[model samples]
Target chain A: MSFREKIHWVTLVTMILAFGWYFLVYPWRIVASPAGVMATAGMLVPVTIAIIVAMTVATAFLAIRSPREVHAREDERDRNIHMRGTHFGYYPLVVGIWINIFLIFWGIGQAEQLNLMIATLVVAEIVRIGTQLYLYRRGY
Target chain B: MAKPPFTNDIRTLRFLAGEMTQGDLGDRVGVTRQTIAAIEQGKYSPSLEVAFRIARVFGKPLEAVFQWDDAGD
Candidate 1:
């Protein structure tokens, strides 16, 4: 596999794992009292930390595994694939944000609103990685 | 499905040029071997500069290496 493809695989797997962890903790937060909810949300900070650590570790490992390919400049195909993935990824993000805005205007709960915002970002990332993986497999 | 708009004889040309590997051509052209493979498989159309570089690697003119397929239109 190309260095870029390896990077994509690492990112996709880590993101899914991190988000799955977040979802598993989500219900626990809902069942908490107001004070307990805040405490439970505090656990989310570790999830973010875990994601950052995972990304750094995976990237470092891949870069070390193929130092030459890592240093090589992006070519036309790489740029094309990046742009296409990012562009398509933006769609779900925009839609999610708009829905959140509509919810705000309609007077949704603050905690729920915040959750939606976080979910939006997560879903956008998932879309971005998924689209990139698909494009890489399909070729551009 | 319609055929790709572009096609090339890169695999054949590489063979003629002392059986050059995809990685060798990519190194000459400053791209990844997968990109070369993609081009060979008609899954990609390279930029003009890279296309020229590939042709230059085999000491051939760009037209001799690559061709446009009107059937794609």
Candidate 2:
């Protein structure tokens, strides 16, 4: 596998794990004050930051280890595949965010959308990586 | 994997041209040896610039080095 492909796999798997943790196992520590605090997804903000930092470190290590599998430059075909994947990645969020607005008007709160938004972001990235892998394997 | 779009006699041509090694051809053309291998196996095709480069190294025309067939695409 090429360096970029290996990086793609590492980033792909890391993001999948991070996404699941952010939306699933991430602890949302509730804080209380005179203003009062409610138990919700607030804990995720810090946890997600930590997750991102950790994954970035891991990916950087992988990149440093294998310089050749990594592409210093892209050939024509690589750029073409990137464009296709970018289009597909953005489409999901357009539908997702618009529907989110619709739901808010129908009385669903912002908190309800938080998990969905995180999920969409994760799935979008997964789709992006999958598209890259697919294009690499299947041709541009 | 995509079948190579072009067929080449690079291996034979190289041999005919004073037994060129993959490294020699790659260095002459400014790409890595792996790329040369990929091109030879029909797993990858070089860019026009790279193709022309490979041809020029042997003092041949572009067509003499790389053959493109649309059927693969």
DockQ by candidate, in order: 0.61, 0.26
Clashing pairs in 1: none
| Backbone clashes counted, model 2 | 2
What tens digits encode model 1's per-residue C-alpha lDDT throughout B1-73?
1336978999999898899999899989998898999889888778899999998888899999998878765
**Candidate 2 lDDT by residue in tens digits, A4-122:** 66667777887777666655653333222311122234556666686788767876787789765455465445565677788788878787888877877887544556655766777
Candidate 1, after superposition: displacement of residue B45 in Å? 1.2
The fnat score for candidate 1 comes to 0.59
Residue A123's lDDT in candidate 1: 88
Every model's TM-score: 0.89, 0.70
How much is the lDDT of residue B65 in candidate 2? 79
Candidate 2, residue A19: the lDDT equals 67
Best by TM-score: 1
Which 10-residue span in candidate 1 chain A carries the lowest summed lDDT?
A: A31-40
